[model samples]
Target: MRLLGIVGWTFCAALLAACGGNGDKVNTPGPVTPGQSSASISSNTAVSSLSRSSNNSSLSSGAMVMTCASVEGAVFIDETCPNWQEPSVFEQQKVNSNIYYEVPFGSDGALVSQKIIDSGDALYKKVWDIQYNNNNDFNGLPHFRAAAAFPAGVDMSAYATGKLIFDIKVLASPEANPDFTVHIECGWPCYSTDVRIPIDELNTWKTYELSVADLIRDGLKITNVAMGFQIIPRWGQQTNTHFQIDNIRWVKGSAPVTTKKCFAQHFDRTDWSYTTKVETVDQMPLDSSKWLAGVGPLVTLIPQWNSVGAAWGFSVRDTETLSSCAAKGTLSVSVLLPSAYVDDGQMQLGFYFISRSGLYYILDGIPASRLKADEWNTISTTIPAGKISNAEYMGVYFDSKGSNVANGYILLDNFVITHSLVQ
Candidate 1:
C-alpha cells in the first residue's frame, strides 16, 4: 500500500476544486432535477486524475524531488535535496566497493563518538567506529541510527542469487551480549524484516553473510534499492555501546529457494462489524450499526448520501492479521453494484490498513469501470514490498462521485491476501 497522506490530500483538493471553494471551505452544490443530464451532474463534482511513476519526469508536482550529483555507475550522494544534509567529517569517502559510508545521527546528547580510522590489519584498511550513550532522559532513553543510501537506486536484478556480506566487531558494551539490527530498505515504508545481530564475544572481528533471497522474501525490492541498509541499536537498554564495522559488499552466490503461505477472509460470517463516517442530507445522524449486514452469505454496505453528492460507504474490519503477509502479493475484494447507481467516472473503491501508530496505508482506488453493475467484480491492488507488521486494522472504502441519487448500496465479499515466506 502507498502512503495515504498524499492520496488523501489530492482527493480533498479535487473535491474542493469541483465544489468551487477555497481551502477548508466547501460549497454546497445545488439540487439536481430529474431532467438534468448525467454530464451536467458530473460537471459539478468531477475529480481530476492523478498518476505516479518511477521515472523522474512522470512524478507529480507534489512528489518529493531528489537532486543526485553522483553519476549512475558511482555511489549516490546528494547535498542539495531538502531531506539530505551535507556529509560530516566522520563520514567515510566512497571506495570501489558497494558500501558508501553515511553520517550517523542519534537522540539529543546520545551520540558519544563517530569516526573513520585506519585498521591495523593488512587486508582491511579502514573501519567505522560508532559509540553512543542510551541512558539519556529523552523518552527515558536515547537511540542511534546510521544508513547507507542509494539516492539514484541500483538495479540489483543481476545479483538476485547473491549474498550481502559484512564484517563487524563489538569493541565495548554494557551488556555481555550486544544486540543491534540491520534493515534493508527499498524506500519509505519499504523495508525488510529486522535482521538481528547479537555479539557474544567482544574485540573479535567476525564476518556475516545474509542471502539476497531471504531479504527479498522479507520484503526487500532488489530492482530499485533506494537504501542498501540501515543500522539501528535496540531500544529500552540504558547503557553505553560501541562497535566497529567494515567490508560491506554484495557477492554473487547461490541461495536456497523459498515458498509462500497465504491467508484470506471470505466475509461470510455473521459476527462481522463495521464503522461508518458518512455525510447525510441536512447532516442528519446515522446509525453505524445498521450500515452493514451479512446477507446471502455476503457482506453488504449501505452509504448515507449528502445533498452535495458526497458519500462514504461502510469500512469493514478484518478479524485476522493478514496485513503482515501482504508483501509480494495482492489485496483483493469482490463488489457488486446496482444498475441504479449511475457511473459518474469519479467513483473510487479500494482497501486500507491502519498501523498501530495511526499511520494509514491506502491503495489507490479502482476506477468505476472495475465495478460492474448488477454483477460481481473482483478489484485488486498490488501490495508493495514494505514493513506493515504494525497494521492493526484492515478495511474497505468507497468514495462516490457527485450523484444526487439516494437508496444506493453495494455487496462485498472475498477479501484475500497472499505472500511469500522463507522456509
Candidate 2:
C-alpha cells in the first residue's frame, strides 16, 4: 500500500505566502515542487528551498508548520540521554566502512555492489544510474543501523517507543527502475523483523508514515525498528536491482487521541513489559463534592472533565485491585509520569487512595491489552468528584500475573499531582 499521501492539499508557494496574517513571518520550502528541477540541485537543493521559505509572508495560526531539516543518517534518542555503548562491535566496523551515513537512506556508495562493478562498461553504469533514478529501494544492502545502544541504556527486555516521517519522490530520467522497495529492520543483538515498503513506482513522489502505535498493536516496541530497503528483483533471484531515495525522516511519534487511547502512552507494551511511558500525567486532589458517570462504576466529574466521552474512568478498591469503567465527569485528577515508565514496558504497579463510595471501584485496563503479562506497561485513571465523596484515599494498582509466576511483580517510581474543578 502507498502508506501515506497528501491529506488533501499541497503547500504551493503562492498558497503558503498567503498564509501569513498580520505579518507573522512564516517559513517555507524552496521553489521546486514535486517534479520541478533546480539550478544547484546537488549541494543546495533541500537547504536552499528551506532558506527561501524561511521568511514566508503567508502563514496561518491554525496551520502546522512542516519544517525540513537535513534527513541524513541519524537515530532516535530519549529525553534522559543515558550513556549508551554500541550493541555490537560489528556495528562499529560496518559504520566505519561507509563513506557517509545517510540515515533512513544509508551509507554513501551503498548502491555500488560487486554486480555493478562487474558490468564495468557504459551499459553497466547506465543500468546502475537508471536504478538510482527510478528505483524506490535505495540503501538496500546495509539495511537499518542504530546507535550502539538506546538513548537511555541497552535493555533489550525493555520496550522503546519511536516514530518516523518523511517525504519521498521519484526522479525523472530515461534509465530508471519503476518498482522499488524499502524495509525497516531491527538489527544486531536484538531480534530481527522487517517491514518492507515500495516507495517510488513509475514516476511518483509520496510520503511514508509509520508509528510505534502499530508496534503496540502488534505487541512490539520502538527499539525493534531499524532502517533498510529491499532491492526489487530483475529476474529469478538475480539480486542486482537498484533504486534512488531521498528526504527520509524518522522519529518517535506521539499517540493520537482518536482511538480509546488503549495501550498507548499509559499501558502500551513491547516484549513482556507494558511499555508506552506516561512521561506526563495531570494529577491533584479532586473536588469530592461532586461526581458523575454515564452509568455504574463509570463515573465522571461534571464540568471539570468537560470533554465528555474524552477521558477514561477507573474505580480503585485498593493498592493492587481495581474496578474499571468508561466514564465522563466534571471534576477529576490526572497524573503525568516520566518517559521511563511510559516506554519501559512495565506490567505491574499499585496506587493507594481511600474512597467514599461503598464499593470503591478498582477500574483498570491497559491502554492496549485486556491484561498483558510480563511485558512492561503503563495505566491512567480518572476519579469523579462524587465517586470519592466519602473516602479519603485511593490509588491505581499494577500487577503481572498469568500462567507463569516469574512475571508476578511490578515497579513504579514517577508520580504527578493535579486536578480539575467538578464540571
lDDT of 1 by residue, 151-243 (tens): 345565545556555567778777777666665656533444455565667877776555564455444556656554345555434247777
> In candidate 2, residue 260 scores what lDDT?
22
List lDDT for all candidates, in order.
0.44, 0.25
TM-score each candidate.
0.38, 0.27
lDDT by residue for model 2 over 208-248, one digit each (tens)? 44333332222223334432222232212212444332223
What are the per-model C-alpha RMSD values against the true structure? 20.9, 21.9
What C-alpha lDDT, on a 0 to 100 scale, does residue 400 get in candidate 2? 21
Say which candidate scores most in TM-score: 1
Q: Which residue runs of candidate 1 sit more than 4 Å off their true CA positions?
A: 1-112, 134-152, 255-423
User: Clash number for every model?
Assistant: 0, 98
Cα lDDT for residue 53, candidate 1: 7
